[model samples]
Target: MPNINILTVDDSVSMRLLLRAALTKEGHQINEAEDGVAAAEWLEHHQPDLVITDINMPRMDGFGLIEHIRAQPRFRDMPILVLTTESTAEKKARARAAGATGWIVKPFDPDQLNSVIRRVAH
Candidate 1:
């Protein structure tokens, strides 16, 4: 797998740690944010190959963050993946509408997550 830069956003510290360990082990550069608000701040100064975000967060949610990213012309085509516990069709449709590139349910497998990053970042 290519060494891609990725932003992993989640409210849970454990989730962020897990993602960092998994991605770093695959030689991918990983940046982390505890919530959507922090992720937004991070995005201000950095551009990553992909963004993986959780749906439920303080200040902003994944859907809201997707809208924010899509609204900006420079980030309009940036790949965004929603990694959340919710798997409802309605939520998926909403995320797609908000410009999410893909959706992955929470408790994600490391290999599957890396595979998705490869596919989307390509």
Candidate 2:
């Protein structure tokens, strides 16, 4: 797959670092934000091929971010993947309703994550 730009939103510094390392290894450029608020601010100036976000976060959660992104015409079609430890059906449904393109449980497998990224981002 061709290299793509990706924005990852999560509160954990280690999670962001892990994602950056894994995605960067696949030749994808990774940008990170500590929370949805930061991600939204970043989105104001930059557009990435895909976005991976955790569901629960301080100062605007993933759902809010997804809704915010969808409200903008420019980012309506951007692929958004929810990556969180929550795997409840309710949460997944809510995320889908919020305009998430897909969901992946936390402690994700790098290969599977990259595969999903390729499928949705391409």
Poorest lDDT segment (10 consecutive residues) of candidate 2: 113-122
lDDT tens string, model 2, 2-120? Answer: 99999999999999999998999999998999999999999999989999999899999999999999989999889999999999999899999989999999889999999999899
Candidate 1: which stretches are off by over 4 Å?
none
Report clash pairs, candidate 1. none
Error of 2 at 73 (Å): 0.8
Each candidate's root-mean-square deviation in Å? 0.9, 0.7
**Over the stretch 18-109, how does candidate 1's per-residue lDDT look in tens digits?**
88988998999899988888998999888888899999998998888889888888887789999999999999999999999999998899
> Which is the leading candidate under lDDT?
2
Please state the error at residue 49 of candidate 1 in Å.
0.9
| Clash numbers, per candidate | 0, 0
lDDT of 1 at 4: 86
Let me know the TM-score candidate 1 reaches against the reference structure. 0.96
For model 2, the local distance difference test gives 0.94
Q: Each model's TM-score, in the order given?
A: 0.96, 0.98
The positional error of residue 42 in candidate 2, measured at the CA in angstroms, is 0.5
Whole-model lDDT, candidate 1?
Answer: 0.90
